[model samples]
Target chain A: MNLNIEVNNNVLTAMPGDTILDALNRHGMNVPTLCHLKGLMPSGACRMCVVEVEGRKNLVTSCSEPVMDGMKIQTHSARVIESRKTIVELLLSNHPDDCLYCERNGSCELQKLAEDLNVRERRISGNKNNYKLDVSSASIVRDPAKCILCGRCVRVCEEIEGVSAIEFVGRGSKTFIDTSFNHGLNVSTCVNCGQCIMVCPTGALKEKPHIDEIKTKLADPTKTVVIQYAPSITISLAEEFGFKPGQNIGGIMNAALRRIGFNFVFDTSFSADLTIMEEASELVHRITTGGTLPMITSCCPGWVKYAEEFQHDILPNLSSCKSPQQMMGAIIKSYFAEAEGINPADIYSVSVMPCTAKKFEQQREEMTQNGISDVDAVLTTRELARLIRLFGIDMDKISPELADSPLGTRSSAGKIFGVSGGVMEAAIRSAHYFITGKELIKFQVNAVRGLAGRKEAKVMINGLEIGVAVVSGLKNAEILMEEVRNGRKDIHFIEVMACPGGCINGGGQPIGTNEESLRARMKSLYEIDEHDAIKVSHKNPYIIELYDKFLGKPLGHKSHHLLHTNYQERDVN
Target chain B: MKSKVEEILQQYPNAGRDSLIPILQSVQESLGFLSEESVVQVSKFLKMPASKIFGVATFYNQFRFTQPGKYHVMVCRGTACHVLGSATVLEEIEKYLKVKPGMTTKDKIFSLEVVACIGACGLAPVISINGEFHAKVTTESIQSIFETYRNREV
Candidate 1:
């Protein structure tokens, strides 16, 4: 059912229920939007996509209005443009005067709209709402002064993430976004996934940066600063340096970190391999010894915290293994310090992650071993890029270099841990090996692959039926968790990554990220898994050597002391 | 408190998103205001997030999060009241009581509120103190109103 529509004096075909915005977008018409999230229900709050339709007196919002047959639409008429400009001005009149020092100074949507609409002069000015900045959360900061009431953060928090940690509070002129009872986010049931920060178009919401602390530590001559980056950062960091997305910059990233004054740089993927070795062995032990039936992966800190806060009943089900970042931190301070003969106190451990929750994870009391903190500081991928730029390191000109030895080497299976289903796939590859002592005939589990929100797969290992489920986005995870709560007994293993599309689309990734970049990042990880010779974590000689030398075996007494930790059921308040 | 909220919530069926506002209103009415415990209980009953319940409850003027004072003073700031300089009257009241709208006096005797209208437009610039309406209020008359409330027996 194709309907003809005249858009901006050009005839365009639309589907039966296609909106004018949809038809125009299909025809390559560029219309700006602020409150419009990609897949969520259309909320015509921003009024930025308002277009004039013939036979209609008022300019209807194209996002909400459906295209009628033979309807004429003008996307950018003088009247529409003026209305948008006025709206921008009205928003600006209430916004703060701190753009020069704002985190999203260049990337703010309100700032961009003002420039696009040529709103140079302030036509209207009045009393701006002076709300205090909320810096309570470990991962995110909320400044109500910069909020334009776009409701993107509120929607993303509730709709996409299912946290609903924050919402629109109060009425009309006094309306502001806040958690329940006007308490800070730290007290709220915020899992600190930072998805709200990623969707926020302004500097109102941003990752709580530890850049100053990192810089101070780096400059300290006595401190031996070491940094480890997550696997997803390698593929996504290239975008920050003006390179195309999915460019594997692993070696160059090592070189860049070297130039940025880090004494040592290691890859969290090595620990990711180490994680599979332990996690897979744990799953096998659980199946054989009548432990927890479906052991959930605890690699994602966001998911771990969610379990601690909301899903306390499922705590026993979570694999007792710390995340790869924490694992690397533990081994670096203990194993690496023992080998290098450096004092653990002097080693300032830092990690660059594709997540904001890593900051919270590193600070968790359970992550500490023997009263000494494992990781000193955690930086998001965005923060690492800032450090690179601050040091004036030319990423493109730097020659490729490998990571530091012993805790550096990793399998391609570990590298794919950055994407959704990769953890389950990697764990399955090793879990099969742990159970049967042979590699899977088909290492590539096509069932658990791709960008599905919730994925399920069944595999037979040594004639033993195994059911596995992979879920990303906490909302999607909640649906599967509901089934688990309802006594559904099919699944034997489950992997939950809080951010949608896994770490490739994590909250701390580059801003303005769309579907194309997400696909590219996921493809790059799969490509590494395809091309690399060592595809399985069990196949990684370094992992086997680590067990032979320091850690006796996976889930052994020594490994449990160093690599594993417990969770505390936190108050939901 | 838990038993009261549970009793009010038991009237609604097991699963319904639309029951949130009504449940919240009932809980607020029974408890005098929605406490953190009441909100959490409502969330458990309806299986809704507390943040969202707060979002809906804060939308209407009929609901109040804080407990009302013994002598709740609601000053009208409607179109007629505004034209008659009710803003000055509100300022005088705030200065005299040493409290702003949405805040109770330190003694807990008076709580100030700015309402849109009280439907007594013919008597423009009205201020209601504990169900008693004073029409055509002025900045000068604010002192006498507070005096009357202060001297009155509870």
Candidate 2:
């Protein structure tokens, strides 16, 4: 069903399903859009796309309005321009005029639109809405005053990523996006995925600033800053520095870190393998003892935070193990520091991750084991890019190198931890080995592998069908939980990560990744998985050596003291 | 909606003042307003005092205890709204009502609320007075729309 619409002295043809803006864009008419994210549907909130309909008495938002046959529309009329200019002026009035100092100054859509619309000044005399900047968490910053409330952050959290931590609070002039009950991100149900920051047009949302602090510490001669990279960071960090998506610069990354004056270069994948040993054993213990049904995986800090907030009723079901990063931090301070005969206080631990939530997770009071913060500071993949650019490291020419000893060496099981369902698969490999005392021939668990919202698999472990469910994104988790509550779900174990596609598609990774980018990155992860010799966590020499020398065994007295954690039921109010 | 409300109320016969907010929300969802009879029924259903329910209904701004005007006009005064010339829209609404925000005219034709952001910044100067979202509102449009609703009521 083709429709003909008269728009701006031109007759434009459109399909029945085409929105007015869609028709305009097809006809080479650019209707300004801000909140209409490509992956999501039209919100029609930003008035910049207002166009005059000939029959209608007033202008209609082209984004939401559908084009009909024989409809007369003016894409650029005097009234339409006036209306758009007014909207832009108004948006600028309340917005913080600090773009010169903003990190997103050159990249901001709002700034571009303001300039395009020729909004010179705000004629309306109004005081800026003052909202206290929130720096409660390590990963993300919340500057309420600069927030346009376009709901891109809210929509991204709820629709795409499926973590509904942010929502509209208060009524009329007082309305703002708030974490549950006006609490700080640290105290709220937010998973700290940082997707909100990714979609935010203004500087209202950002990774918590640590550049100055890191610089100050680097200037201190007494401090030994050791930098570590997550396995996923190797796959995505190149994109931020103008390299194509999925470019591997592991050696260049290490070189870049050394250039930035880091004393030691390590990998989180080493601890990732360690996490598999502990987590896999814990899963087996639960299965044998008839403990919490469907013991939840705790590799992702965002997922852990979500479990702490809305699902505290099922706290016992969560694995007692800390995240791989935290596990690394605790081990570095205790085992590695002691082994090297170095004071833990003098060792500054820095983790470069594809997760913003890791920052918030590191700040957990319980994470501090020996009077010092386990991980001193966390830099996101994007932050690492900034550092790389600051140091003028030519990423294209550099050769990929291996990470440092014991703590940096990783297995295929650890490398796969970057993708969704990888953690479950890794844990299963270790669990099989731990139970049978034999290496499993077929390393891959095909049942739990994919990008589906919720997946369930039943594995015949020694003739017993071990039920396991894998869910990515919090909304999917909610659906699975409802099924559990209603007695409809029958799973012995579950893996839940807050971000879509798990840590590979983390909130703190490089921005502007589309379907192609995701595919490319996913391919790189699987390639790493297929090439590695040590495919299981228990098979990793470092993990086996660590247990033999220091930790004794998984869930042992010493392991329990450092590796496990307890959760507290949060106040819902 | 009413049947669902009745069923929910029956499930919580021993509910006290704590159940007031949920009961009020359920009631509002059903009748669109917390009527006197519904409030009494809620009090009797929960086995709590009627005064307590009334007190809670009036406390939360979300509770619309009174009958709404024929045309509900909620002008967003949120930070996003303020930046988008919402004040001019508010003035236009006041001119039509001959009363300030949070008040209805003598004819009970329109009720107003200076609401926060409706999460529609793209179409700023938005108003969802009676559940119908009107975006990019101008001074002329507000006056003409008021007459349209006022004429319908008369």
Candidate 3:
């Protein structure tokens, strides 16, 4: 039943269990909120959403208060506005005075709230917090001094990600969010998914940017700086450059990177095609040779780390194929360098990823071969956009160009690897070929597609029924894995991406991207897949050539050394 | 200490959210304080985040994170005690014992605690040395009180 209520003299209807904030939002009445995250339980800790109600002595936080029948509320009374202004001013008093240099300078929610409420002068003055920045994690940075104690990061980490790597420590005014025992995140069971950075309203939580390292390598003439962009980056990168979201700026991005002093630029999708050739062959080998059943995709480094920490027993189940970025790095240093007669040590390989975990992934010991690391520096899609701006390149005037040859060609199946179920769909296409020696009539496995946290399907390939599951977000993956651990032998293959919507919504992409932008980016990939002639990775000419000339075959001796790696169990403690 | 915590945790085979406070209380009562190890154990037992356990434990004054000394000293800082120069008495005790509130003396003879009120308004400006209340305590009386507890047998 719906209850009729009056908000600021307007009659509104609210459903049962709807908070006052919910009713107000339904009526298009906006109230200032900081600690309140939609789809999460209302915390009411911020007190910025307080509204006056008739017969109530004190202002009540609309987010936590349920709308009762005939409850007259004043959402924007002078008193309420004054109270919200004071709350913002108090937060500013203790916050650091580094907005000019902060990562969220132009996009900070708290700063925007101050502007909305017209908070000009600071009425309250207090000593600023002197907490040291926690820079231990390769993916994220924690600046406690800038934290406003909104508890958004803590809630998102615990509630959504199900990785309670951080929580509020101490009490009252001395309170701050930190991992258990105040140790840095490297010691904690942090999966490095970067969800905390995605929800942070302020600059308190941010990706550990590698812009300077990329620039330093670019300036060094001895280092032949080469960069590769992830499959999802081209679609999502447009949003940062003032272009509409999901505009395929792949060609323009290539033109921009060349102007920024890059010696060469390649597509990670090419290696994604290469990854499929290896991944599908490995799956086929497992199925035929009585190897580990239910092989899990290890493309997402964040998920690999999660498996290492929480589900060590499942480590053997993870595919040994390195992520497309790492695979590209491996080939570039060995195969690409050999072709050009350049010393591998003199080459600086950089990757522009749609993920923050790639920064951690490139530094993995397994990713290095014979004293040379595959990839040198990893930059987020946001960092690439920042570099483009730093070079003062005019995006509008630049002509569209193609990526460098040799490693430039990729198939539509490889391009779809940016989204959640993309890897499984791509692998199934090629795995069918590997097993039956013929391509499937239908290229797309419609069952394993979209933004759902988890998807499962059964496919008959060469009369062998293969059970497959695709999961995004580690929490969702844990549920599917628990079923697998219980000896449920139906599933034979699994794909796990730590980021909820896959690399399109990766942590390293443009920050503050909503659902609309995610759909747009995902749609762009699907469109590219639909229009391209080469839809199967096994059919890509370069991949076939690479296997014939340099490598003997998929899962062969040289392929194993250059492209594959192993993972070890890690202690959460 | 480890066995005691494990025993308490074992009592609740499938503890949920509601069992946290009682578990914390039981652990603190048995061990005289909640250690980091006990907190971690309780978090695992209840399936609660350690930060939440610490947050809940710190909210109540009954739970102490550190061990209490053999002779726990409590000086009242309530309104009635403050009106009777209890601040000076507390300062004198801290100076003579060389320990601040919530800290134990090097010799383990005394530990200082600043309590809000002991509900003995008539005995204003009172200091309790190991639960033995001293009424109408003054700055000069703190030194003699320390001497009395320091020389006592274990």
The CAPRI quality class of candidate 3 comes to acceptable
lDDT string, candidate 2, B51-151, tens digits: 44554555467777556677778888877778878988898788778877656667777877666678888778888867878888888888777776677
Q: Can you write out model 3's per-residue Cα lDDT over A1-573, one digit (the tens) per residue? A: 899999889888999999999988887889989999987778999999999999999999999999999999998999999999999999999998889999999989999999999988878889988899999988889999999999988887777667788888777888888887677987787888787888788999888888898889889989899989899988998999889988999999999999999999999999999999999999999999999989999999989998997788999899999999999999999889999999999999989998888988888888898888999888888888889999999988999999998788899999999999999999999999888989899888888988999999999997889999999888888899999999889999999998888999888888878888999999999999999999999898998898888988999999999999999988653
**Tens-digit lDDT track for model 1 on B43-91?**
8777788888888888887777777678999999999999999999999
- Local lDDT at A128 for model 2: 84
lDDT of 1 by residue, A1-573 (tens): 899999889888999877778888888898888898877888999999999988999989998789888999888899999999999999999888788998898888889999999999988997886999899988888999889899998888777778889999988998999999899988898988988888898999888899999899999999899999899999999898888998999899999999888999999999999999999999999999999878999999989988888889999999999899989999999889998999988999999998999888888888887788899898888888888998999997999999988777899999999999999999999988888888888899999998989999999999989999999999888889999999989999999999989999998999877889999999999999999999999888988888888999899998899899999898875
TM-score of each: 0.96, 0.75, 0.90
Poorest 10 consecutive residues of model 1 chain A by lDDT?
Answer: A16-25
Q: Give candidate 1's chain B TM-score.
A: 0.88
True-vs-predicted CA distance for residue A517, candidate 2, Å: 2.8
Q: What is the DockQ of each candidate?
A: 0.71, 0.03, 0.38
Shift in Å, residue A332, candidate 1: 1.2
Off-target runs (Cα >4 Å) in candidate 3 are A1-29, A51-60, A65-74, B30-33, B61-77, B80-115, B118-154
Residue A310 alpha-carbon offset, candidate 2, angstroms: 1.4
Instruction: Tell me the interface RMSD of every candidate, in Å.
Output: 1.1, 11.7, 2.2
